[model samples]
Target: MLTAPVRTMILMVRHAEVHNPKDIVYGRLPGFGLSPRGEIQAERVARFLSARNADVIYTSPLLRARQTASVIAGQSNTATVRRSKSLIEVLTGYQGSPNSILVGGFSFYTPVKREGDESMDDVLRRMTNFLSLVIKRHAGEEVIAVSHADPIAILRLGLEGKPLTVENLHSVVYPERVSINQIVLGPDHVPQLTYFDVVRSMETAA
Candidate 1:
């Protein structure tokens, strides 16, 4: 239980590298896990989180996200992981295309807006709501939400007061990059960015 003036924080984590040998956009279709090196990346992230205090973790139902959450939470206490639909990947009608959404990003979304896919605004709304709820619930505690690139990126951009366009989405957070976006919520429930850092991995350095 938190005492007076509880502090709340949440770490937004993008899932590690995925098994995309076929080079197709995975979207929310299913059946994708982390690559071998991606597992290493996950391990590094886990180690990184192990050095901090993560009271609870929330993950998208996607396997890659769940796996990443499991690895990180595994470094700490047990059974504190929960799945939230709001943390799922960007809804896309372009899952099976040879070109990934990262390549064209928001441009591909133009053709599928009427196909019932979620727009950038939709993702921002869902992610922001989810984040607010978690912060309020876990006041005075630290949490990690293992999510897809788009959702995490959208939330970061939204926090920074930027448009949720796909411009530079890939550059903001690379696939399986060891970056973490942290938001510290003040008592008024306003989130302040502590840091949006890309942790350099040993593989990337050497």
Candidate 2:
């Protein structure tokens, strides 16, 4: 007898903008939180998630991600907000450099992979592992995960069978600040990108 597919719904969100007036690359750096505009963005996304009826929310240990998750939990009525290191930001060697340095590297034929920086493959592994556990735990429930830009892009690209290259990562339209990337996984564990919504200045993010 054919069994029904075990569908798992996940809303993968990128945390809102940081309060980085200096415009430096804050990779795995502490003391950075959401800016005023970012708070607004998070609020909009949170209100949007309010109607999603998500069961739980998993966020990165970073302050910005946690803040976003907190807002979502309060607004969406999602009771549980768990912090997962797997959702943390990508480890980059250029943490203290100007943001332009990293952004410019993307357009290069092969982006500079610093010696101490975390490999994209490693990122994919940890992210996928966390997702596996969530899928098993939640089963049929809808959930949310608030993470950073690089990690989020890497996970989505890895799941979608796209190349994990700097060019590809840069070319792919990333989930903007406080945006949602709706994904659905079937029993086969293959994820499908159902929708990508950017929370604009609208009263409601939906």
Candidate 3:
């Protein structure tokens, strides 16, 4: 006999724009908050999720992601947002200088140097571990997770069984300003991405 599959909905969202005008490549850097437009975007995202019934709201420890989650939770009338360091953005290989390159729309490519930061493999590990924990915690409920760009892409790749190499990082598209990716977690402990890069409408009247 085959075991029944667990039914859970995971909404993975990338945080709104940041306040970095110099484009200093603030990978996992502190003191980076959302821009003014990002605040509006976050509010719009909150309205988007207000229509859905979310059991729990989770956010990355990063300030921008946490702020985004807070706004959404407030709109949805959620009591509190859970913060997880595991959901943080990938640590970059470069610090002060802007070494990260944007490619093919929302895809980003960062060349690895000896004096930089974490590798692509490290990012994959962090993303997989965080997703595994989330799947185990919410077996049969809908959960929302707000995080950064690279990690979200990494998680999607992991769920799709794609290789986590530098070349293949661009396979998944990171949604702009509160885009949602829906994933279903089954009993086999694997997540299947149902939809990705869903643009939410800003108007509340709809």
lDDT of 1 at 27: 83
Candidate 3's TM-score reads 0.83
In model 2, the worst 10-residue window by lDDT is 103-112
Q: Which stretches in model 2 have alpha-carbon errors above 4 Å?
A: 1-5, 107-114, 188-190, 201-206
Backbone clashes under 3 angstroms, per model = 1, 0, 3
- Sum up the clashes in candidate 1: 1
Of the candidates shown, which would achieve the greatest TM-score relative to the real structure? Answer: 2
Off by over 4 Å in 3: 1-5, 99-111, 188-190, 196-206
In model 2, pairs of residues that clash are: none
- Please give the ranking of all candidate structures by lDDT, highest first, separated by commas: 2, 1, 3
lDDT of each: 0.76, 0.80, 0.73
RMSD versus native structure for model 3:
3.7
Task: Supply candidate 2's per-residue lDDT for 104.
Answer: 53
Sort order, TM-score high to low = 2, 1, 3
RMSD to the true structure for each prediction, in A, is: 3.8, 3.4, 3.7
lDDT, candidate 2, 1-206, per-residue tens:
11115877878899988999899988889979999989988888887788888999999999999999999999865459999999999887668777787545552124445765678887888888877777678878898999887778888888778888876787776778887778788766456775455566464434
**lDDT for each residue of candidate 3 in 1-206, tens digit (9 for 90 to 100):** 11114777779888987889887878777878899988888887787788888888889998999889988999886436898887888665454566355434432335554444666667777766766676677667788999877778777776677787666676566556678888777666455665544344434334
